[model samples]
Target: MSFNITDEEVKKLEDVASQVRRDILRMVHGCGSGHPGGALGCTDLLVALYFKEMTHNPEFSMDGKDEDLFFLSNGHISAVLYSTLARAGYFPVPELATHRKINSRLQGHPATEEGLPGIRMASGSLGQGLSVAAGAAQTKKLNGDDKFVYVLMGDGEQQEGQIWEAAMYAPHNKVDNLIGFVDYNNAQIDGSTDEVLNLLDLGAKYKAFGWHVITCEKGNDMKTVLETIQEAKAASKQGTPVMVLLKTEMGHPIDFMVGTHKWHGQAPNDEQLASALGQVKETLGDY
Candidate 1:
């Protein structure tokens, strides 16, 4: 279950990603608390990273050793991370039902206090993960480990001063082993990023900070996500940090949920749940 998805494994990943989306819907609906829009939109990217790209061991260690490390800066989207970790064999998939429940290991945002196998640090506050990832990447380099460090952040989070601070620091410190991605879906909690606070020219901004920038115009598409990740990895060693602008819709998969900020943190009602799940086929058994 922890194998990288080669050409023959692509369909298997698609099946598992559908199931992950289903888990996202059910987890948020069951708890009546979660941010599903971003989770749904970023599913393909998570699937590609966990199932096909990164070299990770779900046997779960604090120190990643030679494995590629991933940090989720936009922790509001824990549903996708938890489900993807489960399907990737980090833990039993059935444990997904415990999400957001009292004393559940799967906190609303990922936490290390719960001893979750896949989580490395406690994250919920924005703009901190990139700094942590930069430190981790530097540690890896010190240890002579050539593996890359990956981090995901939301489009709106770019407004945080700390993000730019880290953005400016990574290249200055030559954090070349770090590959950071922004979910440039253009939607946030209050409203669309443009309506709330516009993040214009994300690629140019990263490049201006002395980092190598790549673009994925179709982040929702599996092929495009996979190919772009490889492209990022290929460019990771060019004496500068790498940034990927992963463009996606706020709400995806579900017809009603798609292209709207209304569903960003709202739970679906019974009618909406059925309508949403109808679009994503249950490929793996539901939790």
Candidate 2:
């Protein structure tokens, strides 16, 4: 089932996001690693996609046949994707405990060697997933599959020359089936993106690259997040690929981590985990 979202159903998606956030915190806290800031910030966006937007089977497949595919370019946020995949029924939620451990399919970032059900690429080195997604879009086109290819990247990843090349390639090649998302939280591992390296006017930049661009002003809001994806998909139908600039708080819902760059790769301690968990409701129980 893809989606037929309504106002009343927004709460359902919010519950999914909340539990996913808790999973993210616990997964990172359990392993004492993983990037929670971007994971938490991008929770609503992923939840909106997996739970309410993308049409795909829970059964794993290396070649996603006739289905919508997702690629996580900023692989450091593996916590969110693992949580989303588990919650979406790709695997048992308890499997989240295996993350970051030796021999675990759920690596610190999404890993293909482990044959992770939902991950098509091992994408830790930033600024590469967009091109991968673009290639997948082209494959689907050649295979006569109209399904969409979705990819998410960090705002800081925009600095990479490879990303710009793919950004230019997608629209120029008329790969309209691909939808790209940028987690515009402004926080990167080292510091705020502006402090590190300014990425100005992403909407204008993507538009200039010939992409149909959309802005999600409040990506943390489930309704707005889901609605924005719908808008992006609609925009992608007219022979131009779409790129969405999703504005988010680096560490959303967690009071101490919110709006800061410090939590990018830092896991919360025992007391901190307790407090963070309090802010995010635990639904569907924790893995």
Candidate 3:
């Protein structure tokens, strides 16, 4: 797909993102538990991908041939992924109300056993998604598909030793068809990522690992996100893998939830939900 998007298209995508943020707040509030901070922070990038960037078929398939594929590495924020998938026509939008419910397809983390339309694998463990994405990308290469594989990982997940192993393997094997992201929100459940485990100069680390690195300081902004992703896609398949260091605010537009790690896995109460819903306009109507 072409990366050049019109201003009108950006406005439409912004509308979809607003509705998605509203969906995240409602789903977490309905369940009384979830990771809202990162979900809300990552809304723009997900919206841009499903709505405007990715060449995916919401018709849903496990093989994922002839299309760009995305995997959520930090699956704690399943709220954003579910909402984005539903809004993108992968499933009924009303299914979002069942998030984290008993036996619901929209579980706390993405699961393959549920046979959910968009989910290809179960993903909640911290450091495994990059490996899965690398394997999928390699398969595409071996099959001569020429499509791209994408994955999103949390900055806190960088603390895991397995992440470095995948980092080394992908570049050394010339997995140039893969594009990965690290959500550099800097906050985790215990505290700031720096306090828990300082991932000093993540971009430099990736560069040293023989990967092309792109930095997007304003990950929450729709326009900047589109441009950065376009740049990343253009950089793909050039004999080196690409990584985007996405800098984002934890709670994003909501005031009370922003600026701290406390909201990492905390759900909004009735009043907080109302306040958050009030902040994000319900452009496409609630699910």
Candidate 4:
């Protein structure tokens, strides 16, 4: 499908991104433990997809028809996806308050077991969601559905061999309907990506893997993100898969949290949470 985001739509996405940031901090604080760095880093991209890009009916079930599918490969950041999906009306935003709680549909990682409306597959395990997205893309082609499948992965998660395997399969099988995004924030659970396991030259790596690569220096910028996604869609040919390596600062807009790996899997205390929420206006009201 062709992308047509208006200026008004971009503004709405920006607002949504702010609300998503609020939800991420609140959810992690509620859980008392979870990933927040990657969650904050990917907030803009997720907001752009759910609010301004993807053709999805939050009310509709995940049946793989008439909807553009999105898979979050690095599932530890479920807070971002959960908040975006909720704000987009996939589910009530109140559910975010229950994130990572026992028996809550909002799990620490996305899971089909809860029958979550927006989540099609369980994704905590790194390196698997791309294959799922590729399979969905192939299915759409076979069934004559022209919709696209989008998947998001962390830059560090590339260390998983399964990702490269899916990378090889998507182009060989001509899964042009699939587009993958990497949250190239350079921070993971333990430390910076380069310090842990260097994924340098990610663009060249994707190019060598036979996929079209696009780079976005500021993944958190709404207008730039919208334009980059449009460019990626325009660049999609019938034979090559597309990947966007989005450079973003983890825990962005929160001065204390930005550029640190500490927020990768740690919750903010009450004072810190208040500070974070103070920066983000509660547009559409908090749950």
Candidate 5:
């Protein structure tokens, strides 16, 4: 099922996002380790996708023949994906408590070994998701499945050489059914993406690779994100892959963590968690 964007639905998604943010902080704090910055930054995009945009089934499948598929290339942000999947009904929400715990399906990085319901693949390795997504998109084309394939990558991941290779491959093969997004929050584990490795004119780079490119300057704004996604969907299926550069803030909405790399992979302390939780209302009930 896909979400139709209405005023109420947008508010519903915003509520879900608030809950997901709570989940992210709690999961990381529970484990004493996990990436929170990128996860928080991308919550709105994933919430928008599973709750409002993509035609997907929470009833799990490996082959994903008929429904749209999504891959999390920047797999370190597993908190957001796990929380989103659980909130979306692929699994129970309370399982979030087992996050990063041994033998739990909700590992730190998504893994297929446990046969997690919403996870399509294990993807902690940087810059590999787009390649997998391109292949999946081509598979759907060969099978005549009209559903689209979606992938989310980190802007820091753009530094990986494999990303450039896949970037070139998708357009050359005309994988228009695949839509990719880069969480361009400008911050990474070490520091800012510009401080680490500058991805100069990322949208232009994607366009030069022959893909249709879109930009969302306010990725944290749910309405803007939903509208930008709508625009991306309209541009898809023409002949080339689509890429959306979502300009988001790392550790968004959390005052202490916003716009910095300090929280990229750090968990909040008891006091910090308390403060962070205080910021987002416990919408949809916390796990």
Candidate 6:
């Protein structure tokens, strides 16, 4: 099934993406440390989900009744996620400026201690979110709620033994309501995923684990991202979980940062941030 996204909506998504990029920079710069590469790479996907696809009301609590649930397995990218959520009305966008600062609800990694409206679980330890998402999916099933549980994980995170354990369990338990996404950007904090821990033939691996694997070669492309997610949603009907390997360029659209592992947890200095922000227009007024 083909899904059509209007030009106006595309413009809106681009606007949101720009604001998210700004927020990421400001958030990281404010704290003096954080992950910006994965955050930037995943910006468009978060914008697409919150602005278009997901059935969510940011004003509502995290109980998620009549709404979709999102879990960020790559929790280090909290800047992008928090910005997207705020822009989507999950909370005041101004709060993003306090990200990673001491006593702020937006921690270096997301935590439920603050009881933030959009965040459901504490993450950042890695390899645990899939299990958390699986548990949420099961809860939704038990409650007779037909909402979807979405999760995003990094490609390097695939090396975690727990991810494979979750992969093996989800399908066997018939967790069809869950959809997992891998930000297959190749680069990790240390180096390329291939260099650190190769995840060759990831699609085949997901298939082997009983998931219907889909690939999105352009994770930064708004239209392709939306279409691929729509297709995955359409294809989830046979009691098997779905996984999409999204190939993204870390720090995409920035000449200096793209395709490098150095940007994974580094913050751009004043000049670099200015240069990066100049490349992405502020379509939506910066908060």
Clashing pairs in 2: none
lDDT of 5 by residue, 54-84 (tens): 8888999898879989999999999999999
Error of 4 at 164 (Å): 0.8
- RMSD values, in order shown: 2.7, 1.9, 1.4, 1.7, 2.0, 1.0
Q: TM-score for candidate 3, please give it.
A: 0.98
Task: Please give the distance, in angstroms, between residue 182's alpha carbon in candidate 4 and its true position after superposition.
Answer: 0.5
Candidate 2 lDDT score relative to the true structure: 0.91
- Predicted candidate 4 versus true structure: per-residue lDDT over 1-287, tens digit per residue: 44576788888878888888998999999989999888998999998888878889878577758788899999999999999888888887788898999989988899989888788999998999899999999899889998889999999899999999999998888899899999999998788999999988989988988999999998989888888888888777558999999999999888889978888889999999999899888877888
Rank list by lDDT: 3, 5, 2, 1, 6, 4
TM value for model 6: 0.98
Alpha-carbon local distance difference test for all models: 0.91, 0.91, 0.94, 0.89, 0.93, 0.89
Which residues of candidate 5, in runs, are more than 4 Å off?
1-4
lDDT of 3: 0.94
What's the true lDDT of residue 169 in model 1? 94
Error of 6 at 52 (Å): 0.4
* 110 Cα displacement, candidate 2 (Å): 0.8
> Following a full C-alpha superposition, what root-mean-square deviation does model 5 have from the true structure?
2.0
Q: Model 1: per-residue lDDT, tens digit, 1-287?
A: 12223665677777878999999999999998899999999999999999889999999899999999999999999999999999989889999999999989999999999899899988889989999999999999999999999999999899999999999999998999999999998888898889898887878889899999999999988877888888888888778999999999877878998878888888898899999999999988898
Error of 5 at 128 (Å): 0.5
Per-residue lDDT of 93 in model 3:
97
lDDT of 3 by residue, 1-287 (tens): 46697899889999999999999999999999999999999999999999988899999999999999999999999999999999999999999999999979998999988888999988999999999999999999989899899999999999989999999999999999999999999999899999999999999999999999999999999999999899998998888999999999988889999999898999999999999988999999998
